[model samples]
Target: MGQFIQKTSFSEKDFLAFQDKLHQCLEALELVLERPGFGLGEPSIGAELELYLLDGEGRPVLENQAVQDTYDDPTLTLELNRYNLELNFTPLPGTGAPFTALQQQILDNLAGLNQKMDPWQGQVLPIGILPTLQERDFGPQVMTDLPRYRVLAEAVQQRRQSTGIRIEGQDSMNLVHDDVTLEGACTSFQIHYRPRGQDMVNLWNATQLVTPLMVGVSANSPLLLGHRLWHETRVPLFCQSIDGLNSQSEHPVPPPRVSFGQGWLRHSLIELFRETVQLYPPLIPILSDEDPLAVVAQGGVPKLEELRLHDGTIWSWNRPIYDPCNDPHLRIEMRVLPAGPSAADMAANAALFIGLAQGLSEDVEPLLSALPFSYARTNFYRAAQHGMGASIYWPNAHQNSLEERSLAAVLEQLLPVAEKGLIQVGVNKEEAQTWLSLISDRLQSGQTGASWQLQQYNRLVGNGHGNHEACLQLLKAYCHHSNANVPVAQWPDL
Candidate 1:
């Protein structure tokens, strides 16, 4: 969805010329919101990460096109599996030491993809779900040959008539596939956040009421194919892997193109790109010659590329982008963290989401009218199945209702409201207390990254080591404690 389409078989006249260039890119986003100095004047931050390409015994290594033809960099790319790979960094400016320059640009592009996967032994891991993944490693001949990922696995397996695709927590799956290439087994790190003028819908509803306290202290995937499911099995294996296409007769209950929405967005931000072009349908209608209303009637700034390829197939954990390059901002991606156990635990989960998105975008518009988008979508799947032992439901006040609490009493009342929203956005209160003290020492040592990968996979299966050699010795001690950048609460325990 990062633009690049010539063909993948779209035709109904290419979905009526991409719904007439997605209604002229929603009338050039209401003429760039009646132009009053568009975005990027200060708050800026970015990331993408998404790794996993292992081999030397820790499985899955599709050579990401020979490490993108031997890593010629331009922020690398390709992902939708071929053993995945995605980097994309540049944005930066949300105040000093920007997470130590995005953790030294992700350890200098993970040491240049570990020196080009060392003569093809191929390693580069950064995980979310790769505990030796398998189920015949997600079929469709290991996807990523790309024609827009085979027209998005043939439009989400032709809108689910292919059926079977189950997932339940503590180990349970179900199959039947033709191709949504099991959503390339899941991988994420995705942060973004631009937020300038009109504090972008109160920092997108304070990032949807703090995505379950940033997926409950950033739970990494707690093992999948080797069972031991959800601490964050990539959040219901990425919302039941590309589900959607079960029209089973009646209509109107729509909204599950992988979501935690259907409420709260009390108006403009073009009502989430007009409810994603009025509720999905064009999983890749390809055609985009870009005329976002003749480039905003020639004043310039268009690239809405069919409303950013139909809002990049809507897997919204907290999406709503719109980046027409050169100072044309409007961000808020934050797709519920989860990438690795390191780069300082993904820059302390991006400094607890840029200090709770600048301390709840300045008092989240009257605490979003006393919160209740169904308790922030049921506190995001109960913090993706109990990571930090879930219990959520916040917004207190002499208990007028929603109480529940405990992710250490909601990180002791939001880590001093994300360190006074990272020292009111210019950060540097000792670089926002060194990445919010690694989320307050991973919430005072509760140790998350899925509780240190379920306590080092049950202490390497209680010292005997079985389940695929204890998930390749917990992926070789989680790549030597994520290449020694450390942070999963000081690692060591296993």
Candidate 2:
């Protein structure tokens, strides 16, 4: 993880200047001929693990300072909120045994994190959505005193003019949270895979095709404002919660900055940066006169001012990423996954992603030719809204329920291809099986993170333990019960 700066006060003019600089950088691209990224034949691999720092009762814990005190490792760094922490898995250059190594390192880190939290009545839960997360948990006092986060809150609120939440299910909710901390209810398992320069276009398309399936498999955060609207309500909440456009915005409005893009990767990665720079204004600004190209000439890596700044502002689901890399010097960050029940489960999830991304690039173009994109895209929102229970609007004029084109249905068709791709990249059989099986079992049982959480929530509720506070307590208990087991069937139910 890179160092984060403390947010400083900025005038409106500062933001506008940053946007103007970004535009010039995008324009500068047109003057230079972009070349194919250089890389070895080995596949790209990366992972991001988000954890909820919790107390023994499963309530949000602020042991950030203690955790930081215990370790000097930058890889395990503080998140935007004090209750949140993130682990940036080291990049694996070649694929052989890489997943296994990542698993071991992550487990070791988790052990260390748990030990540190123990004395403080704190622990880190890997569940996709901590069932106990509630409004009380995200109040001002809990807000991490970080400049970046402050800037984000102020910037988004100023533009969106509202928190924009509306959940309707067993219960109904329509409230505005002036701040975006409500977005903090989400914690995810993020994965990154390196795509070949020659096939980047196809990989982007395949990722779009698989977005809904991905969300369905990892659905969590089903209950919001005490309602059961969707299995993975995080999707809509995140987009709508931070949307800048006011109600006056008309139809065919620009998509919220966050989205599973309808358009394909038409050109270079620079195109993504350019579109963002052109559409959304900058929210944070810390500018310098240091010429990035001059640094490149000095044999130093150029951080590409425009690209990095624009990257900070616009966050799409399947984000275009540029990171320090030995191969391709860039990788795609798949940001849609929810957190995990156990460390192994999270590792397994990451493995499944690595395999699927590699496999999809080689197989999807022809397979997707006949599939209507609108259904696939819409179904993702539906899954996020309703989780496993919603009826999916079928592709084409023909109607097909989500249960009909189930996540399991899609996985069965695609997992083997992903398996082949993972195997080709040198993952051991057990490594692949340990992770992939979780997905298989979850789909077979139709129990996503959100579903399991809701089930657990109801069990507590029937026991007269129902309330915002009870939900958090149950999350605390679930973490206590499920620690490192990957085989969900063997793991005792909550």
Candidate 3:
């Protein structure tokens, strides 16, 4: 979705030509994958942190372009909404103290952004969904003035005709939208891991398996439109916001544009790309001049521009990325985690995810057999809905069956697995411990970003504050603690 296309509307001819190019890109990808040493670089990790910009009163502010102009940082980029900005962090080698390095980069970049926003009386916030967001905040007017975002909104609205969001948790709420701007309300801290080609299948499957645990422990964005929704409201909100098919349509609806996935990757990562091409119609079919097949034959890297643009539209929770820049590589974009609490919490979340995926991949086959793919999918939503309080089905290796377990208890058992996985990936022993210990403390305290927000909001409401005032107070304290870089587990209630 980051790739920019000037045209807002596509003709039938454009769609057909783009489809042909997509197939060509797939052929080129096969050749590239078969080539020795391709995508076999040293493992590394990167991240994109999406944030919300707010005014002094803790309301969403439309000052992203101004901040971008003043900051003059290449890493800072605008998101779907004017109030949102994303920071792209540099990739670091997945060894030694990578998490520590990542933590520092997050802190530094956020500090710079906040400082730049000071002149505008704007503040930067990193949260899954800003609790203070109102229904009026998500209209066509709030979308960023970019061709890519406009075209995307038009495309989604064209397909679905109308967007409806109905989420049920502690409370139930139903809303409608004319465009996809509602998705902009759900910010995330997306982590990227580049693994060796041979390990892609195992690593990808392991990532899917462990996602529920990660989402549960790091759950945030519990409130949306002043309603107490899922622990991670972003999960459901994002999917429903841009869903292409209407329930009233008589045509057979395909899988959602945003989804967990139809099933596991049976053979290789190629399966995922193939599924993307086959299952979803092209949303943005902008053509490129270069012939991918010709580029592969001439021993050159093919950009696969159309394929990448189309892939970006399919918002899989764990998406596969094939980058043709420099040395071509494959990356698993871990999109399940929410954006904030603090930089420390985000780093720990990344460490836990990368470590568990790598560690579980060693014996992923057995684990997958013990816990069916369907179970894994169910567990993901369960965790998102209930956070640490959710009960998920896990593989009981000794019993050779799946059993329902509390998310917190499951996380406790997985800590050692995560640490081992990090060590196996060449991370320093103490570095691994330093980050995983945060997860440990978070579990013990039973206070994730979601729980903390809910607690504070309810506490304020109990003291006779109105819903809006309570949300504002929650955001104030949240920003204060987040800017202080204090972990959510250690945050004090208002």
Candidate 4:
């Protein structure tokens, strides 16, 4: 999605050409994957943090372009909304102290961006959904003035006619929009893991299995449009926001553009790319110059631009990535986690997620057999809706049956698994212990980002602040603690 194109429109011919290219890319990917030395390197991890730019009143501010103009950092880029910006960190090796390095990178980059925002009296926040955002904040006008974003908006609106969002939690919200800008309200801290080609299947399956547990512990973005929605409102908000499938159509509808997935991946990672190309129609079908088949024949890596762009359009919680930059490789992009609370908190979330995925992959077959994929899907939504308070079904080896267990209790049992996974992946013992302890502490305290936000909001509201005012005050306190880089578990109550 970061690859930029100037073209704003695509014709029928363009779509046909792009579709052909996608198939060719898949063929080339199959051959590439079979090569002896392909993607054979030490494991590495990277992340992209999406954030909100806010004004003195704790509302969204449109200054991403201005920040880009004054700030000379290439890692920082504009998001779908002008009020949002994303920071891409350099990939670090899994060994030594990658999580600690990630934490520092976040602090350094965010500090530099905040310094530039000082001139505009603007502040940067790394939350899933900014609670103060109003209905007027979204629409055609709020979209970033980029060709990709504009074309994406037009493409989704064309397919769905209109996007309707109906979320029922502590408060209910039912609204509709003609454009996909509502997706801009949700931000995330996406983690990228480049594993050896042999471990791809196990790692990918493990990621899916542990996602619910990760979401439960790392829950954030509880409030949206001041409605106090799901503990992690970004999950449903993002899915319903840019959904392209129209139920009114008489033809059979495809899976949603944003989804957990239809079912568990059976054979290889190639199955994912094939399913993506076959099931989902091309949204932005801009043809690339490279012939992937020709590149593969010449024993060279193909950029697979069309397949990548198409894959980017499909918002899977765990998406497969094929990158030809530097050395050609495949990576699993974990898109389930939200941004913020603090840099340490974000790093801790990543550590637990990556560690658990690695640890569980060793025995993933039995785990998957014990817990059905449908139950895994159910657990994901339940975790998002209830956060730490949610009870999930887990494989109880002792009874040889699936047992309903508290999310916190499940996390407690999984902490050691995560730690061992981290060590297996080459993360130093001290680094693994330091980061995993944060998760343990958070679970013990029952104070995830969502819980803290809810508690603070309720307290302020009880003290006579109006809903909107409480949101602003909560955001103010949030920014203060987040800027201090304090863990969410340790943040003081308002």
Q: Count the backbone clashes (under 3 Å) in each candidate.
A: 2, 9, 0, 0
TM-score per model over all chains: 0.35, 0.88, 0.97, 0.97
Q: Spell out the clash pairs found in candidate 2.
A: 7-147, 58-476, 126-340, 127-340, 132-471, 132-472, 230-385, 231-387, 392-402
**Superior by TM-score: candidate 1 or candidate 3:** 3
lDDT of 3 at 42: 78
Q: Please give, for residues 1-494, the per-residue lDDT of candidate 1 as tens digits.
A: 75566577766887987887787788888898777787747887899988888877888888788888889886788898798889989879887778889989999898888888876565787888888887888887888786778777777776764365555766676666545666677788998867545567777887788888888888888888788877887876665567633532234345567777777787577888888888877678766566677778888888777778778887888888877777786778887787887887798788887688678776777666667787777788888888878887777534566567776677767887887887787778888777888888878888887878788888888888888888888788888888878888888765
* Model 4 global lDDT (CA atoms, 0 to 1): 0.88
Candidate 3 lDDT tens digits, 101-215: 9999999988888888786687788999999989889887898999999888878877874557888977798876656888899899999998644578899999999999999
> Would you list the C-alpha lDDT of every candidate in the order shown?
0.78, 0.66, 0.88, 0.88
Off by over 4 Å in 4: 2-4, 196-198, 244-252, 397-400
The true-versus-predicted C-alpha distance at residue 294 of model 2, in Å, is 5.1
TM-score between model 2 and native: 0.88
User: Of the pair 2 and 3, which is ahead by TM-score?
Assistant: 3
| Pairs in steric clash, model 1 | 159-245, 342-345
